[model samples]
Structures are given as C-alpha cells and as structure tokens.
Target: MTKSEKTQIIESLTIEFKESNAIAVCDYKGLSVKDLESFRVAVRPLGIKVQVVKNTLASIALKNAGADGLEFRDTNIFIWGEDQISLAKAISKFAENSAGKFVIKMGFFEGNVVDTKHIELVSKMPSRDELLGMLLSVWTGPARYFVTALDNLRKQKEEN
Candidate 1:
C-alpha cells in the first residue's frame, strides 16, 4: 500500500478506536480461513467489526488516538466497535472451542488497558441490557411478594 493509503487506513482506525466502547487484541495466527470467516459471521451479527491489521499500524493508530496505553504487540487482530461486552463474549466463546487457534492478548475499555484475564472477566460480564433487566427484576421482587401476600390474605378473609 502507498503512504497515503496507509495514512488513510490509520486515520480510519484511529477514529474507530476513539469511538469504540472496548477494543480487544488477539492473535489469529493459526486460525483456518473457514474458521476465521465463521468467527467474523458470528461477531458481525452482534455489530462488532473484526479487523486484522498490522500491529505497527494499530499501535500507530492507538497513539494517534491518544490511546497508547493499549500496548498491543506482535501480530494482532483487533476486535472492536459497538456493544463491546457482546463482542468479547463472542470471541471468548469461539476461543473456547478453537483453543490454540486463537488467543486473547489484551484489551482496552473505558480508557484503561486490560490484560487477558481482565478481558476474560469483561467477557463474562452481562451486557448492559441484561444487567438492566436483572436490576429491574430485583427491584420488583418486593412488590411482587407484597401483592402475593395481599392476595393470600384476601383469600383467607373470603374463606372465613
């Protein structure tokens, strides 16, 4: 690629890094083409953009975006975009089966550089919508119990 083309690509990557909710660096060295395609298909449906970019280019883009703390190294494929936790979960799930074919390197989230273990933890976390639903269920538990108790009391009164 020409210098201008590389610059444009880097600019685009910088923009993506800036806008992303989370960014994960992974090694895709041993993945077969079919497996990689399958991985892409799985992640794309969840609105994640998975790109295999030169590690130097990614580092440069991260620096340009003032996110040098990401600390990506080696040949890295970047998985980033919307709904970061979902993307992480999808990748983690795929890796669980692929094993040695793929591996998590590092991740960036909320302006912090997360190691592989932290990335795995993030992957295990519930999505925002799921967390919200769980919180709603918890919040309504007392109300539900109160209503049930009232119904039982009315049933007893009617039987008397």
Candidate 2:
C-alpha cells in the first residue's frame, strides 16, 4: 500500500480502538479465506468487526489508543466491539471449533491486558443483556412481594 493509504488505515484503526469496549487478538495462521469470511459473517450480526491487520500498524493503533502491554505478532486478526463479552464469546466459540488453527494471543478489555484464560472465563459469563435481565428481576422482586402482601390484607378484610 501507499504511504497515504497506510496513514488512513492507521487513523481509522486508531478511531476503532478508541470506540471499541474491548479488542481480542488472535493468530489466524492456518485459517483459510473462506473460514475468515464465515467468521466475519457470524460476528457481524453481533456488532463486531473482524479484520486482519499488520502487526506494526496494530501496535501503533494500540499505542495511540492508550492500550498498554499487548504484543502484536504475525498474522493477527483483530476482533472488537462495544460489548466486550460478546466479542469474547464469539471469538471463543470460533476458536473452540478451529482444532488448532485459531489461537488466542491475548486481549484488551476496559483498559487492562487480559490473558487467554481470563478471556475464556469472560466468554462463558452471561452477556450484558442477560446480566441486566437478572438485575431487573432482582429489582422487581420487592415490588412483587409488596403487591402480594397488599392482596393478602384485602382478602382478610373481606373475610372479616
């Protein structure tokens, strides 16, 4: 690519790093183009963007975005999104089926460098929507009990 093109790519990647909640890096060395395209399709619906980036450019973007301590190496496919959990879950699922082709290098989430183990743990955790639903249930529990108590009182008054 030309110098201008490289500059543009860096600029855009820098923006992406700034906007994304988390970024997952993987070594997609043995994967085919078809596999990569299929992976992209799977993640696109989840608001995730996957791309193969040159290590140097990615390093520059990461540094520019203030992400400390991620080493970029050969054949890196970057997966990033607003929902960190979804990114982790999606990549984890994809990697799970890859036998040994897709390897997890590391990740950056909420300003921390998360290792592969942590990424796997995060992947298994419920999504943000699921967590929110759980919280909503908890929040409504007291209200439900209050209404039931009021109904019981009304029944007693009627009996009297």
Steric clashes per prediction: 0, 0
Cα deviation of 76, candidate 2, in Å: 0.9
Q: For residue 22, what is the lDDT in candidate 2?
A: 91
What is the C-alpha local distance difference test score of each model? 0.85, 0.93
For model 2, state the Cα shift of residue 134 in Å: 1.5
Residue-level lDDT tens digits of model 2 in 93-129: 9999999899989999999999999999999999989
Candidate 2 regions exceeding 4 Å error are: 142-160
Give the Å error, residue 12, model 1: 0.9
**Candidate 1 residue runs with Cα over 4 Å from true position:** 70-74
lDDT of 1 at 45: 71
Number of the top TM-score candidate = 1
- Point to the candidate with the largest lDDT: 2
